[model samples]
Structure formats: C-alpha cells, structure tokens
Target: MPRGRPAGVPPIGSYTAVGDSFTEGVGDPGPGGWIGWADRLAALLADRHAEHAPPGSFRYANLAVRGRLLDRIVAEQVPRAVELAPELVTFCAGGNDILRPSGDPDLLAERFEQAVAALRAVVPTVMVCTGFDTRGVPVLGLLRGKIATYNAHIRAVADRYDCPVLDLWSLRAMRDRRAWSEDRLHLSTEGHVRVALRAAQVLGLTPPADPDQPWPPQARPLRSQVRRDNIHWAREHLVPWIGRRLRGESSGDDVLPKRPELVPLELPGAVEA
Candidate 1:
C-alpha cells in the first residue's frame, strides 16, 4: 500500500546526503559499492513520495566520500548541496576531524553551524547526525570524551537551526561487535540498517524494524580469545591505518561520489560483501 503523507510530516521529494565514511557507506556493501544508511533512508523516503511525485521525479544524491574531514566537506560538498537545492539534506561530517589529536570540537562545531545555516536557508529540512559512543571499542574508546564533546556541539547546532538529529551515541545496540565491520572504524551491514531505521524515526517516518532491537545474550568471550582478536585487528586494520597517517595518504584521495546528482533512487543492489 502506498503510504499517505502523514499529518504534520515533512514531505521529502528529494534528498542529498553529505558526510564521510559513515554517509559514504564504507562498511555496507552493495553491487554499486558500499550501501550506507543514507541510501537506505533515501529508499524509505522515496517510497513514501513516489506515489505523489511525477513518474521518476523523486530523486536523491550522495556527495559523501570516505576519509573526508569536516573542513573539506563544508568547503567542498556543502556549496554543491546548496546549488542542488534539494528539499531535504542530511549533514553528518566531522567524525574524521574528531579523530585528530589537535582537532578542536568547538571550532568544528562552529564550521558545522555555518554549514547548517547555509543549508537551512534554501532547504526546507536539514538533518544532522551525532557521533557514536565508542566507550567499548578498542582504540576509539580512548577518544570517547572527545566524541562526546563533539556530539554535544553538534546537538546544539541542530537545535539552533531546528534541524533533526540522528543521535548515534544513545544507540546501545551499536556497542555489540555485530554492529561494526572488521575494520572496527565503520559500521557493518546490520549497523547500517539499524542506523537507517533510526534516521527514519528521527524524520517522523515509520521504519520497518527497531534500531534498538535487543541482541541475544551469549557467554562472555575467553580473555585469551579477546586478546587474539585484538592482535588480529591491530595487524590487519590498525597498522595500515597508522601507515596511512604517517604517509599523509587518505583512502579518499582519489575517490569520487558514487551519485553526484539528484536522480531516481536505485536500490536492492545486494552483493556478497
């Protein structure tokens, strides 16, 4: 059944996603490449709107590339999004900036405020996302305070502009290993689905599943096994990440946005990721 636009709901005919690996679908794989939460949310929004729009008129774009910093996203992607002038825009950058030791949360939020101000001027609805709680993760755990601080600043910015916020910090289910990819930095496929659902909830849309669905309890891992996993993660993922930093090379150094323009949404491109 085609869902009628709910009373008081903001009708989204078009949406443009802006961000880093999280929005770029770094961990979620589709035939097109990585299918992130942005694409999934686009699917949901499209379904709700397709019935009302002219055939194939409901459109979407994704300007996110992995490994992008907030400055670059604001400096490069933000202006382009403003030009596209979509009815809806999602802004979820600054995580890459948070990871840096010298990155200032206050300064990043200031830049973010400017970006949101620009988007809100032309866009009817602008959505933003918060950083995740990394207290249980290995290396990221150490930076939990910084992430929290940045998240606070983001929330304030969202409030100032009346923008909807997808809060990743309170998603307790995400602490589970199943929600994360092998790299430990990005979300797994399941995580992406959960986040998509959560984003829908934020937008006053009905999601098919609960983002906070409880996980089945299991026995605690043996300390030695945990040690082994840590060692393997360090070897397979951590070392290479460190190497990239030392060499000042980024994963997105040459990458481009998969979908740079607002077009009809394409989906279900499932691949054996």
Candidate 2:
C-alpha cells in the first residue's frame, strides 16, 4: 500500500473481516441472511477493484461469527485471516466483552490491542471500530462510561499502529433510535448502510451517496405502549441472551461465516446464501 493519500480510489484487491455479530451482519437482514456493514463495504471495494484491477479481481472473506469476544476472535479468526493476507482487514470485536459485567475494560482493551497489533503485523491495511454510545439502552446504559473508556483505548491503539478507524462513537447518527434494531443491541439495516459508507470514507473510497441523513421525527408512543413493548423485548431478546450467557452458549455456536473464502463480490442487487 502507498504511504501518502491515495491518488484516487484505493485498490482493494481483497478484504477479510473478523469480529463478532457486528462484522457478521447480525441486525441487517438480507434475503440470504444478514448482510452487515462489512459486506456492504466489500461490495464497494469490489466495484472499485473492477474499475482499476482485473474483472473479478476483488476477493472477500468474512470469518466473523456472532457473539465472539476479543480473545475468541484473536484465537480463532486472526490466524486464518492473516494466512489469507487480504489487502484490507477490518477487525471489530471487544464490544461483547465490554458489555459483560465482569470483564475489565482496561484488560479488554489490552487484549483488543494485541489483536490489532497481530493483524497489523501481517495485513497491510487494518481497520478497527469503537463501540457506540449506550445511553438509550435499558440495562446497558450503565456501561456508557466504560464504553467511552474503551473507545479511547481503541483510538490510541489505532494511532499506535497508524491503522484506519471507523469511529462509531463519534457517529451522531447512531444516537437516533432508528439506527438500531428493535432489540437495541444491533444496528438496523439503515444503520449498517451508514456505517459501511463511513468505513469506506475512512479507507479513502467514495461512497455512492451518504447514508447518514437525519431521520424525521416519529410519533411518540404512549407510556403504556412503551412499557408493554419494553416488557416484550425483555422477554424475547434479553432473557434469551441471559440464558445463553448462563449456559455458556452463543448465537454463533453452530453458525458458520456466510462467506468464509475470499471470492468476488456479487453486484449490489445480487443475493447471497
């Protein structure tokens, strides 16, 4: 890769993403499955590669399985990604660890730093992301301070390695409730679209258009309605999450990466299985 700013669009010969559900496209539902920001960005990279490189030159791999912690990502996915040696690598993990009540934010950051360092050591261009604010969340709101602290460490680590950062904390668009799914834990499809565009900008690629436009005001629900919805959400999403935690299970326990190999990205409208 070149040192200075890219002449025009940077050529992404290939891309490999590793992390938890965020990178796995959990919230953003697709016809085949979830297509998160990583896949969106890969499509963009593929378009660029088509213009500058050979047809089908751009390859992509996603080793991210949902519910993975920093150590799990480093232990399981990092080595495989390093072996693939893609031109671009996006690593977004440690969010799940930060959400845990028992984990130490500082220690988690240390582990996150190691993962970033290891990836940077092998991959030419490494990208990382910070956790978003949790003020709007119910039980998770208490961890706002911790999330901020962890984000600071993420920025520091990226600075240390001169890696590109997708600063999710700085994205004010995410503050809107519309940016998240009903569960409030993962991003909505629109949110993933915005993130993908921002990540492309960080990598010096021009997105077709911005997805961060302000959302219009929505009608407020009644207090009773809000309470009922919260209760339902707790029963459906929260309880299951807790049950999994108690049993040491993960949503990705039996899941595999949707795309495990570096292959040519389909066109925007094409479906993935």
The Cα local distance difference test for each model comes to 0.87, 0.84
Residue-pair clashes per candidate: 0, 0
Candidate that scores best on TM-score: 1
For model 2, how does the per-residue alpha-carbon lDDT over 97-190 read when each residue is reduced to its tens digit? 8878877889998888888888888798898888888887799898999999988998899889988888888788898878889888998888
Candidate 2 global TM-score: 0.93
In angstroms, the error of model 2 at 195 is 0.8
Q: Give candidate 1's whole-model lDDT.
A: 0.87
RMSD, each candidate, Å?
Answer: 3.4, 2.8
Instruction: In candidate 2, list every pair of residues with a backbone clash.
Output: none
Candidate 2, residue 242: lDDT: 93
In angstroms, give how far residue 71 of model 1 lies from its true place: 0.8
